[model samples]
Target: MQLQLQTLPKVLSVLVMEDRIDAASAIQFKERLRDLTQEGDQRVVLDLARVQFLDSSGLGAIVAVKKLLGPDRVLELSGLTPTVERVFRLTRMDTIFTIHLTHEAALSDVTGA
Candidate 1:
């Protein structure tokens, strides 16, 4: 999987290119997020519109990122595909992170809309 990083005014967005975020890509995904979060943006949003699948590893990666961000930082998720959304729901991660219907919404939420 390839993760594309985009920087917005107060948010750092990550666009995942792979449909499945499994063990194969989890490590790389975490590393990419680590590098991006180093930018120290107050908000971080992951764009999962293109990701059709997310496994336990993917969920773990997200959780790890959230922990790394600490309470002072904000972490949100956006554009979750149905399958991916189901995974989040099943894992009860939906309640743990802020989720938005679109990237714009995530940005707006981060900016305090």
Candidate 2:
């Protein structure tokens, strides 16, 4: 997985460049997230536009990220493709995450724009 970490004024954006988040990359994903968010206080927006596939491990990895962040910070998901969105919805994970149509929207929400 190619991950880009961008720290904005009031949010940290994590752009996922891969098309799939399966068991193979799940551990790496979680580790990378831990590293990327170690020093941030702003909300985290995970960009999933390129992620067309998300398996059980991927979902578990995301949940682990949330736990890693703890209660004070939040992790929102943005730019989900249809297939990815379906997985979240089908698994009832949508309610756990704040889903946005675009990365800009998620940024604006966190920055209070």
Candidate 3:
């Protein structure tokens, strides 16, 4: 799993450069995200543009990340492919986290652009 971490003013953008976030890489994802968000910006956006698939394990990992971030921090998701989006929708995670159509849109939302 490759991740491009960027700091944009009040937000930390984590662009996941992979097609799937399944049982295989979920743990790593969680660990890496934990390391990145330890003491930085409270606003985080996960870019899932390249991710076309997500399983229960992956979903759990995402939720775990959000919970781990605590109440003060916000974790948003962006660029979910239809398949991936459906998983979140079916699991009712769409209501739990904010979803954006694009990374730029998420950035705009946080940056007030």
Residue-level lDDT tens digits of model 3 in 21-108: 9999999989988888998755999999999889999999999999999988889999999999999999999999989999999988
The alpha-carbon lDDT assigned to residue 29 of candidate 3 equals: 88
By summed lDDT, the worst window of 10 consecutive residues in model 2 runs over 104-113
Tens-digit lDDT string for candidate 2 (1-113): 69988888788899999998999999999999998899969888999999989999999999999999999998999999998888899999998898899998888783432
Give the Å shift of residue 73 in candidate 2.
0.4
Q: Each candidate: what lDDT?
A: 0.82, 0.90, 0.90
Cα distance off (Å), candidate 3, residue 109: 0.8
Which 10 consecutive positions of candidate 3 have the poorest summed lDDT? 104-113
Candidate 2 stretches with Cα past 4 Å from truth are 110-113
TM-score against truth, every candidate? 0.89, 0.94, 0.94
lDDT of 1 by residue, 1-113 (tens): 58888776777777878888888888888887787787565677888899887899989988998888888888888999898899989888999888999987887773542
Clashing pairs in 2: none
